[model samples]
Target: MDAKQYANLIDKELQEMPLYVFYYTQQPNLSVTTIYQYLTEYRRFFNWLRETPKDIENPNAGSISDAKSNKEIKLETLKHLQASQVQMFLKELSIKQNKQSTRDSKKTINRTINALRSLFHYLTVTADLNDGEPYFYRNVMLKIPLIKGVKESISYRNAKFSPMLYTGEKKRKWIDFIENEYEHTISTRRRSSFLFNKERDLAIISLLLGSGIRVSELTRLNLKDVNLRDRSIIVLRKGDKKDAPLIADWAMPYLENYLKIRKQRYQPDKSEQALFLTKYAGKAKRIATNTVECFVSKYSTAFPDGNRTTPHKLRHSLGTELYDKSKDVMVVATQLGHTGISATDQYIQQTEVEKQRIQLDKTK
Candidate 1:
């Protein structure tokens, strides 16, 4: 829905309805996306506002006629709304201790309330009115506290490292298919595509399977970033400026081949120094993130077991296998450029029930 039109409709509702309230849309500091979100949250509240009990004393509310939709009312006048009204809105947000009347998630409620609070705070701080009390409006807005968010779901530490994808033989099948067995389909479009991208495709898969770098990181590579002789490429890591290890032994040959093809195709800096280039005519551009996803998805037929796999899952397979071999969380974490060990622990942990199944003897 168009935010401007929704805001306009809400303003119309406020004007036609029996309420004396002002709704402002201007927030100079906010981004366009942020402004859209604030408007959407306010729109939700305003949709339910007409049905909500009016605690605020409004003289104009009595004069307005009732409409089927609250959107019919137009709001022009500005009026003071008390903290009690804000509290009433919060109380109606949830039905039970765990359930919400608005059916909004706690995270969503918290965001909406923050948006409301931020707007009011902005108004309160910037208000020019000084009727012997400079802090009056600001104090009213300060009273609007954040709606407490619900706790997150249980951690993977207690749960089994569930749904571990494309490991062992499954991992081999995918690798083999990409490295040797992959082929174009009978369709004209399928056969025509990726002719110039064969080496590029293999290199992408090799990087994921060998180095386990993120799709984003792969897309961000430069021509100078690779070193085939060293069999390592410097990868930008999370948080710190330190480089992550590039152990793409299998990927080096593919990278060299792709680079050779890239150099020949995009001779004399035609690739514009991007490590990966699109197969476009004339001047080629850098590969896109969505394009990388499409690149990985093109060979889903590689999974002979009919199980689905993704690049991240391949990354997970690398981290998981590393942990399985060495049982070192920090090693896996550092390899993956994870900021914390807690985030890395999920790759190693198995639930009690799942572990018990593995413990069962084969003779039984």
Candidate 2:
């Protein structure tokens, strides 16, 4: 087959492969997001495959920039791909530049490899990988190990490289900003259901900024998940059933107020099992992940420069604050629902006062 036909065939197959593996395979509880990300990785690989220098009878291969004689990509080529090619692909992700000389970040490169690993595992075991013909990529992909502890420095986006983790004055300023500026602005705004939304937004923002709740965890919460009496929430972190994360006492008032308004706003019969609902629709429906992101985008203006005010940022802010107050790794771990200390360690940051003292002692 010529390059153009092969390219068209490959694109069509790659698109169908993930769904076939996801649904037809016997795996359970894999979230939609994981499948989406894996599909993205497949697209990235195939895009580069078009430019690979092998003499595949593909006509469009020349259309890809800098096509060379050393590489080739095709459905038939996948099974033949040895470990060396896989390693080269993974390495190229971090170092390879586009026409603009831009490269993927260390974090993204790592994730892309993970996605490849998953897809290749599927290709190895499945019949035709949902693309009408059987592909035996298992030998190649399953053998490809994760890249780790490499001596080379990882590339990252320098433009927005500052830690999103809030600390000290930045942390305190945000707390006050949300409490005073955000809460007050919403409370006083001349809009319908201002009180209802303010109460709800405060509860959400406070929960994220106070309890270190992941935005996914926050969205997944149900009425049964919350314990108003003990101010605790039973959150399913990373899809595992775990002990409930406790809510801050101060955030309770907002939760109490929001629940009261939510009940009044939505009819009991039509309301879904979602803890957070949208009022924009006549029928109160669950707030989607996109809604949660848009909500953060809407209120991000309240934060000062250097403080990126996304939901994850708020969680980091709260985690750092909790660590500062408790000085306990377990405390941070339990609240954030992290299974390990290494994961929780990233959340804990030195307060400005502590940093200042350390610097003073350094001179002394």
Name the top TM-score candidate: 2
What lDDT tens digits, residue by residue, belong to model 1 across residues 1-364? 2223445665554453332123234434553345556756665555555455453466445322233554553332112455676666666665424334346566766787787776556455643344533223434446777766655443532332234355566666676776555553336566556556778887787777778787767776787887777777777544325464667465577777887788786553543777887755666777766777776766754445534557777687687767776788888887888877887655665323355667775548
Candidate 2 achieves a global lDDT of 0.64
The Cα local distance difference test for each model comes to: 0.60, 0.64
Runs off by more than 4 Å, candidate 2? 1-15, 18-20, 23-26, 44-53, 56-77, 82-103, 123-138, 142-196, 266-271, 304-306, 347-356, 359-364
What tens digits encode model 2's per-residue C-alpha lDDT throughout 28-61? 5454456456666766676665555443367554
lDDT measured at residue 215 in model 1 versus the true structure, 0 to 100: 75
lDDT of 2 at 159: 18
Q: What TM-score do all the candidates reach, one by one? A: 0.59, 0.70
Lowest summed lDDT across 10 adjacent residues in model 2 is found at 153-162
